[model samples]
Target: MDLQDQLKNLFPDHEPEESTDKIDAKPSYWLQDDPIICKYEKRKGKPITILEGYNGADSDLKKLAKDLKTFLGVGGSVKKETIIIQGDFRDKIMAFLKDNGFTVKRVGG
Candidate 1:
């Protein structure tokens, strides 16, 4: 006999309980009211994109930084809650953040 048949034979009156836990379809992070600032700058003669003004947990910010780096296929880091991307990708970054339910404010050219 199969396992299910054995179990049914052992517990004839027992009924399986339905699962009540709800799983979120997508992962969500703390979204702040203030828009995240996306700016461009040249540091040591290399163009870089900086995203700042995030008023959320540092871990979330770091996760965001890691996601951005992977999405853009570039190197970056998070320092003091600010995300520093290795290239000038303000427009793309802003669009990605907006799509992920974060307000983005583009600053400087």
Candidate 2:
């Protein structure tokens, strides 16, 4: 099943949180639905990863982008509930979230 479908089946009451894109030394941890992390297609093959969800808002998502970028020392952004980071940071991403108290699982790779 697709990420969204799996997430819906996993948590029916899942809600969209908010991200402000601020640079916080301590990022928030979230056990959210499926997050879409794919290499960005544009920018001359820059290793960009895009993370999207069924829920989550611009502010919270922006926060995610900022935190991940700083953590991985890469570039990224957040828009329309999507957080895009420039790099294949799947392993680091999952570990970072978990280390900060967020439950996570690798959906695909």
Candidate 3:
């Protein structure tokens, strides 16, 4: 079963009810521009990929990361809302973001 199905099975009374758009769905004053940040760090002297700047809920970020990982054919994770893949893909990610209509600016060196 899927995660949502599993959750519903665990808590039958709390089954999800499809409703109107969430308050956050609108362009609000509190929302940050959603963009994927790509960075490389050392992990025990090994290079590691860190994709950050995902500003959303846990499940939503996780789902986005999962889809991205599948498309990139790389192993990655959704950590604290950051999508950490296994390699540096700043150019690739920037292209993806642009194709999706998200304005992007590469921040770090």
Task: Output the worst ten-in-a-row residue range by lDDT, candidate 2.
Answer: 33-42
Candidate 1 runs further than 4 Å off: 1-26
For candidate 2, what is the lDDT? 0.65
Q: Rate the local accuracy (lDDT) of all candidates.
A: 0.90, 0.65, 0.66
On lDDT, the stronger of 1 and 3 is: 1
Local error of candidate 2 at residue 3 (angstroms): 57
Overall local distance difference test of candidate 1: 0.90
Q: What is candidate 2's TM-score against the reference?
A: 0.54
Q: What RMSD does model 1 have? A: 4.7
Q: Residue 2, candidate 1: how far off, in angstroms?
A: 27
Candidate 2 per-residue C-alpha lDDT over 1-109 given as tens digits, one digit per residue, 9 for 90 to 100: 8998988899999985788687875666444555444433445866666655525555666666777798899877776666777777877876776676555545553
List the candidate numbers ranked by lDDT, top first.
1, 3, 2
Backbone clash total for model 2 is 9
Candidate 2 lDDT for residue 103: 54
Instruction: For candidate 1, write residues 1-109 as lDDT tens digits.
Output: 9998999999999998999999985457888899999999999999999999998988888888888898899999998879999988988999899888999989986
Report the lDDT tens digits of candidate 3 across residue range 1-109.
8988889888989956798766753222222576556677767776556767767677666766676677678888776767777777777766765665555567567
Instruction: Give lDDT: candidate 2, residue 28.
Output: 62
Best by TM-score: 1
